[model samples]
Target: MTNLLLLALSAAAAVAPADNGGAPQQGLLPSSPWNVDYAEAECRLSRTFGAGADGYTLRIIRGANLKGVQYVVAGQSLKIRDWNHSGTLGLRPGERAYKLMVAWYRLPTGESAFQLLADDALRPDEIASTRGLVMEFDGAEPLVFAVGNLEKPLAALASCYDDLLTGWGIDPADIRNLKTAPDPLDLHTWHLYDDAWIGKAEKGKIWMSVRLDVSETGKAVGCHTLSPSGSAEVDTKVCVLSVKNARFKPAISTAGDKVKAPFILKIQIREQPATR
Candidate 1:
């Protein structure tokens, strides 16, 4: 796993100023054309790079809200020994690089993968104007790829995100000029039970999609589980805890006025291992 110190160092040493001009190969591996998927509750963009033992698939996923874009990499190339690592993402023709904490996930294919969930998402303009991406991990060498034109794919994903909002009774038009989506004012309080209780149940993970009705005051007036977690008790616990701790910064308009809006999130809950 990459450490924060090394991640920062790599960014400064390797990342360069991005522009509409294509990124230097810099040993950047060739990649497949970008693919878009309108999943059950998320939008996904993915591509594969490298060959043989060095091959890997990179996936970008966004849920119902405007933030929390997750970057996932899967393949036999990277081993997962820890729950977290430090990683960086740099865009081609993009000036700044983003550092993130990468968490491990085992895919259905039994491949070990690392996931980096970004707190902020790039604007649609940025996505459309980009041509490649650079990713770095501590123990492994960086993976650079020519991601191809994303204008149409990104627009389709935006439409998918809007459709997700509509499912929550939100009108896409009402969210125009949105400055920020709802986020926890106090991260500590928000995570106290962000994962539903599974202490007495099976040992696997429970995934659920949830929607929160945020009042103008940023209070969670209502919480609803839009997707099932396989257990009724687990689902109830998730909503109950989420509502009690939902002090958030309500969505803000570009004009700086706070507006009541629904926020959607995809949550994964697993039984915490007992500590000695």
Candidate 2:
């Protein structure tokens, strides 16, 4: 990871600015290459970076006073309870640096979550024009993100964000309170009891908490166990099944605008003896 970050940064540094003869017109594309999904009153713009299936998923969600993007790498098997750290954001190669908070969640299997936040929500043009982003996680290998050719997608996202804000009669940068908390996750919806897990259940209770990154559509794009259950299978199963089966009411802002937010799902599985 360290080597990859260094090499990518060096390459970004070597590229010279395009010469438009004056004012350095970048000739950014008119459209963005990203995909957008709207649910639960929020709009989620997503795009994947890097090659193969091993890259990362970049997700943007709008909130009351906060709007940020999350970097997700799949198939990470780290079982750490929780982590809170600070990091630096290097944008446009040698451009000015921004301070960001690093929050991560380690889930079942090999899945990991890392989120980045700026002091305030960044505009669409700022995000689209950024050629490269280097996320320096403290004491860990930094990850390089490529953000070229995103004009059209970002423009679309910006328009969508503005439209939503305008419809709510709120400023683009203002914050609001949640009108109502998001709905709780319903395990039965996914038929979790039908899984082999129920067959292996003993006379003990299994309790687990899952951190969910719920999208605008009320779908969980990412799920991680908040704490370990003595049983790895139970922990993993709960996290995996919840993402697929769990449902939320979708959070609403005080201004009557729907948005995406992080939610915690608590689950308790209790076994009963067979009754003849």
Candidate 3:
């Protein structure tokens, strides 16, 4: 997910944050303009903070249905100590801190990075103010970016997201006044839950965000994966199983008519917890 409001931490070698040993904060100036990537599989928007550093990026990604988001951060001096490399992160526009979950990720440059996911703490619209981002990690120095309002940039992003839905064969008009979002037919799709466990990675977890194109008659007509990383076999199975087993209640319009709509699902694949 693009960090739409990520006035994030210090970054990798290319754009690492200032190494302030005992400094109180790593304050950054809004450096670059917002960049939106309309990729084949995802809609990502990003911007660089901290004096226009190449890697000082604040990227937030909205899901296909716009119900949730994911964000990524890369800090050069970030240290990891926990068994799962997980930590608590705080983001605030002014005073109230928004709590979020932070996890480790490997940047394409082979450096370590951090990311946040779809937890209740991050209510994007609530925190998406123009005040920029003030990020805090427990005992570490604060990461600050003096960015102004975000209303315009986010509007552009919403436009891009609508265009993406069209590309996936889902009508943008269908969701404008949706009385109900599509509901999953089952609690667990065994095909998907089972396929996710085969030959899983040795460590960490992967997030899979998928889009389902549901017809007015409550049938899945198309499937798309917003996250293109990880095993191709599992990716293929996601679509295959979706068509065969992924069922949903057709979205209802405010006019009391069933309408074709895009359904979104974000799932996490990780090792089953140790049950003694």
Candidate 4:
């Protein structure tokens, strides 16, 4: 992880200005060769840098469709001029040291989520005032990262953010209370139950299961479980939820002379109803 962080920092530091002659012309496509395509009828843009005499030229181009473009350098948001169309951004000779990328998407509903990617793996010291999700990658170039999905790399980032908060002595309740983006793992409810138990003088056995639901709004609504007797119990009372992850266990007892068996009950959470 430390090595990956050093590599990313080095890459960010290596960004340099393009030579005078190779600077992309006003009407030409952005100088970089990387491209992005949006499959859901949305606009996309990609940026790439090219080696030039002085350093490199950064080219950013619009997708087949026009979507707005914004960049964050040193934590400051800069609205790219003439970004409605393709354009070249001239990096000052020493200014290639910028290390962060903040991409903003104007969702179909006018809501937006900022996708923050760092050139360096985030160190505990680097995230002091950070208020959003953080992710780390340790692989080849054209490195990929994402957010807002349970199975994607961003999920790991969400976990890191939670850990950072905890490590800093920040109260989890306060962290959750802060106005932030909706949780991707908006689990409404989680349930765990045992089916049946069989016990003998020599051996015992048990069964267990769990269920949960996530909503479009990224909020978990209901979580519950049933005991072997088919009685409903609020599972949250016995579990601690950290961001999207949770840990829990049930109460059980065993006697030396008498073998005891336990069966898990049932657990279920309500998911968002399917759209017609």
**Model 3: per-residue lDDT, tens digit, 1-276?**
123123243332223344435322325655679888886556777877654323456776765444445666654433442334344444433345546667665554444456665432244565475454555555544555544566666777778878977776666676557767676687475357664454552244455767878788777788887774377767777778887887788877889888777787666665433321
Over the stretch 16-97, how does candidate 2's per-residue lDDT look in tens digits? Answer: 3433322112211112347776533345677665433234556665532234444333223212224447778766634557
Segments of candidate 2 deviating more than 4 angstroms: 1-33, 51-53, 64-84, 107-110, 123-128, 166-276
lDDT of 4: 0.27
Tens-digit per-residue lDDT, 71-105, candidate 4: 21110111212222221222222223233444433
Q: Judging by lDDT, tell me the better candidate of 2 and 3.
A: 3
- Give the number of the best model, judged by TM-score: 1
Compute each candidate's TM-score over C-alphas. 0.74, 0.45, 0.60, 0.19
- Write the candidate numbers in order of decreasing lDDT: 1, 3, 2, 4
Q: Is candidate 2 or candidate 4 better by TM-score?
A: 2
Preferred candidate (TM-score higher): 3 or 4: 3
- In candidate 2 the C-alpha lDDT for residue 33 amounts to 49
lDDT of each: 0.68, 0.53, 0.59, 0.27
Provide the global lDDT of candidate 2 against the true structure: 0.53
Q: Name the top lDDT candidate.
A: 1
Residue pairs with backbone overlap in model 1 = 18-93, 18-94, 19-93
